[model samples]
Target chain A: MKEKEINFEEAMKQLENIANELEKGDLSLDESVNKFEEGMKLSKKCNDFLEKAEKKITMLINSDGEIKEEEFKIEEN
Target chain B: MEYNPITVTDLNKYIKEKFDGDEMLANVLVKGEISNFKRHYTGHLYFTLKDENSLIKCVMFKSYTTYLNFIPKDGMKVIILGSVNVFERDGVYQIYAKAMKQDGLGSLYEAYEKLKSKLSQEGLFDVSHKKKIPFMPKTIGVLTSNTGAVIRDIINVSTRRNPNVHIRLYPVPVQGSGAAEKIAKGIEFMNENKFADVLIIGRGGGSLEDLWPFNEEIVARAIYNSEIPIISAVGHETDFTIADFVADLRAPTPSAAAELAVANIDDVKETLRLYNNRYKIALKKRLELMRLSYEKQIARPAFKNPTQKINEQYMLIDMKVKAIQSSIQSKISEEKAKFIKQIARLDTLSPLKTLTRGYSIVTNESGKTIRKVSEIKTGENINLRLVDGEKKAKVL
Candidate 1:
C-alpha cells in the first residue's frame, strides 16, 4: 500500500506525479484539487527543508572508503 | 591402346565422377579459424578456412548463406558441415562449405555491434534530440526489476535527498529475450500515461551480456523517442550502454540518478526563506531612502520659512503703494502749480477769470444778465449771479 503521509522525497515525487497528472488532463476536478493540495504540501515541505538547512560543508568517508567533502565556497548573492 | 575423343558433356561427367569417387573427400568435418569471409556481390560467401597446419578454400553460395543471421568475420572459430571436393579447374581439394555454426566466441559481440551500428545510424544518440531533465521533478518513474537492489537504492537515495519525491515503480524484465521490448514498452507506457515527470531507467552493474538489453536497438530507440526526459543508470560508472548514450541524462547508478531527479525539500525551503528576507530588506531600504528624501525636502527654506515668503510679498506690495502715492503726490503738486499759474495768466486774458477778479456774468430776465438791448424788456425782473453772492434787479 502507498503511504498517505509522504516524506520529503516522497512528497517531491508525489508533487511531480500530481503535476504530470494535471498536465496530462486526466484527473477529475476533485482529484485534481486533492492532488494539488498534496503537491502544495510537498512544495512547502521542500521549501521548509531548504530554509532550515544551513550551507554547511563537511567531510566524511564514503561507502567505497574514499574521503569526500564540500569544496566550493557558498556564494550568497 | 586406342583413346576416343570425348564430347564436352561426357568429359565433364567423367571428371565429376572421378571427383566424387575420392573416399577421403566426402563426409569431412573441418575445424579452422575463418578468414577472407565475404558476402559476395551475389550474396554468396567466399572464405578461406585455415588451421595452423594447412588451409582450404571454401564457398557457401547465396542459397545456403541466406539463413544466417550474423555476418561472418575473419578469425572466427567455426565447424563447417560439408563434403570435401576438388575444383576441376584449380585441381585443388577444398571444402564445399555448407551449414556453418559458431564453435566459439558466441554471437553476443556480433549482436552488440549490429545493434550499436543500427541505432547510431538512426540518430538515436543525437544530442539535439535529448530532452532536458526537469529542474525539480516531483514524480520519478523507475523501470527496473522490482526485487533487486536497484529499485531500493533509487527509493532510498531519492527519499533521503528529498523526502517528498514520489516514485512509481514500473517493474520490468531487465535481461534475456523480450526484455528489451518490455523496457521499451515501459518507457512508452509511462510517457503515454504521464506517470512521472522524469523517468529513471536503470539496473545495477552487471556483465556486458547482462546489460545487453539496455544496449539493444529497440531500447535505445525507445529512450531516444521518449517525450519525457529520461535518466539512464544501467550499470557501474565504467559500464556504458546504448541507453546511456541515448538518454537525456546519464547517471553512474540508480541511486545517483534518483538523487539528481529530485531537489531536497530542505534546500528549497531555505532558498525561499532567504529570498523572503532579501525582499524585506530591499523594501525597508527603499522606504528608508524615500523617507530621507522627504526629510531633506522638509528642511529646505520653502518649507521652513513659509511666513517669510508671505512677508516678502507684503513688503513688495507696500513698497509699490508708497512709490505710487509719492509719484501721484508729486504729479498732483506739479499739476496744481501749473493750474495756479494758468489761472493767473487766464485772469489777465479770459472773461471767466476776469469775473473771478470781481467782474460778474450778466443775463437777461429769466435769470439772464442783460448784455444787449434786444435781450431786455421794458419792465422785467432779473437776478445776477456772482462769485460769492446773488442779486435781484429791475430793468427799465
Candidate 2:
C-alpha cells in the first residue's frame, strides 16, 4: 500500500475510519485484517509525531521585505 | 487709601472687584475634599471644598455642571477649575467652578468611556466579528512590556503546559505616552509577518490610569483588525479594557492567556493513547468474531468429515447399482420363460414329435416333404421319417 504523506490530523482521521469499519464487522476477514494493520500503522505514526515534537520559539524579523527568524528567549522576571 | 467712607454694599462690591481683578483668583485650580455637596433644583452643584485647615465654598452652575463626568458628592476628593470671587450678598469668597474632575483618573475614565462607546457603535466589539482562537496554537505572540512579569508569566505558563509551544514576544510599551500606538503596531507587525497563531496583548494589573493605554482607540482597533486571533489580558480579572472587548478572546491575565494559547501535550498524547486502545480492542473483537465464524465453518460437516459426504454419494451409487441388477435379472428370467413356452409349442408342431405320436412324414429324393401325392407317374425314390427311424422306399 502506498502510504501518502499524511499529517497528524489526517492520520488520526484515517485511523478513526479504519476503527469504525472494523467495528461494524460487516467486512470479510481478509479486509478487516488489512484495515487493522493500516490503522495500527497510522496510530504509531501519530504517537511518534506527538512524542518527537520539540518546542521551538523564534522571533520573526522583517528587514527590507525579507523575513528572518531569530532565537527568542523569555527574560527572567 | 480711600478718603470717603463707603457703604457696606459699596465695600462688598469693591472687595468683589479686587478679587476678580487678581489673575490667580480669576482662574484658580484648587484640590480639596468635597463636603456638604448638593445638587440644586436648577442642575447647579453647590459644594464646600476644604483641606485640613482651609475651607472654601464652591459652586458649579448648571451650565458647566452638565459637562461634568461624575456627580459631585460629599467626601469625594476633586479638583475644581474656576474663579474665586467674593459674593456680595454672602460677603464671603467662593469658587465659581467652571469645571470639576475627580482627583485621579476622572478625565481619563471619561475618555475611556467615550472611546469605548464609539468603538462599540462601530461594531468593533461585536461577537460576530471576533475570530475563534485556534484549539492548538503552535506559536503565541506577546505584545506587552519587555521589562515586566507579563511576558515571563506567559512564557512560564505556556512552556509548562506544552514544552513544544513557541512564544514570540513583540516587546511593546504597555503604558505611558505613546504606548497605545506601539501596542497597536506590535499587533499589526505580528499580523503582517504571520508571526504567531495567536497573540496576547496586555500587561499585568494596574490602576485605571496606568492601564489607560489599553483603552486607547488605536489599541482596540488593532485588536479588532488583527488577522491573528488575539487574547486581551490587559489587567487583572476585575479590570476590563477596550482591548478586552475587541479581542477575539479575553484572558483574565497574561498567564491565563498563555494557558488558552496551547493545550497540554500530555492530554493530546493521552487522547492518542485512548484511540489506540479503542482500535486495538475493536480489532481484537473483530478478529475474535471472525475466528468464531471460522470455527463454525470448520465445524461444518463438509469441513469436519469431508469423506463422509463422499461416503453418502457411494451409498447412493450402491443402491442404484442394485436396482439396475435386479431389473436385468428379472428381464432375463422373463425372456427364458417365453423361450420355454415357444419351444413347447414348436415341439407340438414338429413332425418328429408327431412321429413319436405314431405320425410319420415322407420326402422325395430331392428332400422335399410331400404333403399329398395325387398320382405318381413313375416310381421315385422316397424317404420316410419316423419317431425313432428313417427308411427309403419307392413311391407306388
Candidate 3:
C-alpha cells in the first residue's frame, strides 16, 4: 500500500477505526492481519509526530495581501 | 445685613442647605482609586477617593455597602455614584455614596451579560452545536497578545505533552480601543487560511476592563463561525466571557487549553500497545474457532470412515443383482414346460405316429393322400404308406 502524508489527528482516527474493526471479530483472518499491519503503521506515524517534533513558535504577519511567517520568542515577564 | 449678623452655626447651616439645593451636586459620579478604605463594626464603609492631584472623603452606609459585590481595598480603582454635600457641624464637604462599581469595567460587564444572554437565546452556546475537539491536533492556532504570558504558557504546556504540536500565533491586541476587532480578525484569518486543526483564543488573568475585548460581540461571533474548533481561556478560571459561551470548548486558562488540544504521547503509546495485543488475541481466537470447525467436519461419518458408506451402497447393488437373476431363471423354466406340452399334442395328431399304432396313410398315383374311396375312383392305382414302407395295390 502507498503511504501518504497524514496529520496526527487523521492518523489517530485511522488507528481508532482499525482497532474497532479488529474488536468486532467480523473480519477474515487475512483481512484482520491486513488491518493489524495498517494499524501498526498508523500508530508509528502518530508516535513519530510526537517524537520527531521540535518545539517551535511562529507568528503570522499579514503584509499587503499575503501572509508571512516569522519566528517568535517568548520574553521573560 | 451687616447690622443683623447671624451666628456661625446659622452660617454653616446656610452653606449646607445651599450645597444640598444643587441638583448636580446631589447626584454625582466620580472615578478614582480607593485610599484609606475602612469598614467599621457597624458594616458602614469609609474611604477616600483620590486622583493624582487631590482626594475627597466618601462614605457608604451599611444599607448601600451591603450591595457591594467585592471588598474595597486601598489602591483599587472604582467609580462611586452618590451626592456631594457639606456637613454643617464639621464644615467639611464629603460624598455620600449610593453605589460603586469597578473603574472602566462596570459598563463592559453589562455588555458582556447582554451579549451572553442574546447569544444564548439564539442557541449559539447550545451543546448540540459545539464541535468535538480532535484528540490530537497537528497545528494549534493561537489568538492572543504576542508578548504575554498567555502564549508562553500555552506553548509550555502543549510542548510538554506532545513536542510535535505546531502552534501558529496571531498577534492581536488583547484589549484597549480596537482590540476586539483585531481579535475577531485574527480568528477569521486563521480560519480562512485553514492553518490549524484547532484554535486556542485567550489571555492571562486581568481586570474585567482588561478582558473586555473577549466580551465583545465581534469576538463571540467569530468564535461561533469558526470552522476549526476553538477553546476560550480568557483571564482566570473565575472569569467568564462571551467568547467562552460561543466557543466549541472552554478552558479555564491558556495552559489548560493547550492540554485539551493534544493527547499525552505516553498515554497514546499505551493505547497503541493495547490495540496491538487485542488484535493478536482476536485473530488467535478466530483461527482457533476455524480449526475447531474443521476438526468437527472431518469427525463426521462421511469422512471418518468413508468406506462404510461405500460398503452400504455395494450391499444394495448385490441385492438388486440376485433379484434380477432369480426372475430370469423362473421365466426360462416356464417356457420349457409349455414347449413340451405343445410337442406332445403335435405327436398325437401326426400320421407317422398313428402308423406305429396300426394305422396307415393311402395315396393315389398322383401322390395325393386318399381319405375316401369315391374320391380315389375304383380302378385307380394307389399306394399304401405304412410307418415302415410303401406298396402299390388296386384300390377296389
Q: In model 2, which runs have C-alpha deviations exceeding 4 angstroms?
A: A1-18, A25-77, B1-132, B147-153, B163-165, B192-194, B204-211, B236-240, B362-383, B392-396
Query: What DockQ does each prediction reach against the true complex?
Result: 0.05, 0.39, 0.50
What's every prediction's RMSD, in angstroms?
15.3, 10.6, 8.4
lDDT of predicted model 2? 0.83
lDDT of 3 by residue, B218-252 (tens): 88889889999999999888888888888999999
For each candidate, how many residue pairs have backbone atoms clashing (under 3 Å)?
36, 1, 0
CAPRI class of candidate 3: medium
What C-alpha lDDT do the candidate models reach, one value each? 0.74, 0.83, 0.86
**Model 1 Cα RMSD, 1 decimal:** 15.3
Global CA lDDT computed for model 1: 0.74
Candidate 2 per-residue C-alpha lDDT over B134-249 given as tens digits, one digit per residue, 9 for 90 to 100: 76665788888766788888878888888877788777778899999988888888988788888988899865767989988888888888999999998889888988999999
Sort the predicted structures by DockQ, highest score first: 3, 2, 1
Error of 2 at B225 (Å): 4.1
Model 1 residue A13 CA deviation in Å: 20
Clashes of 1: 36
Rank order (by TM-score, best first): 2, 3, 1
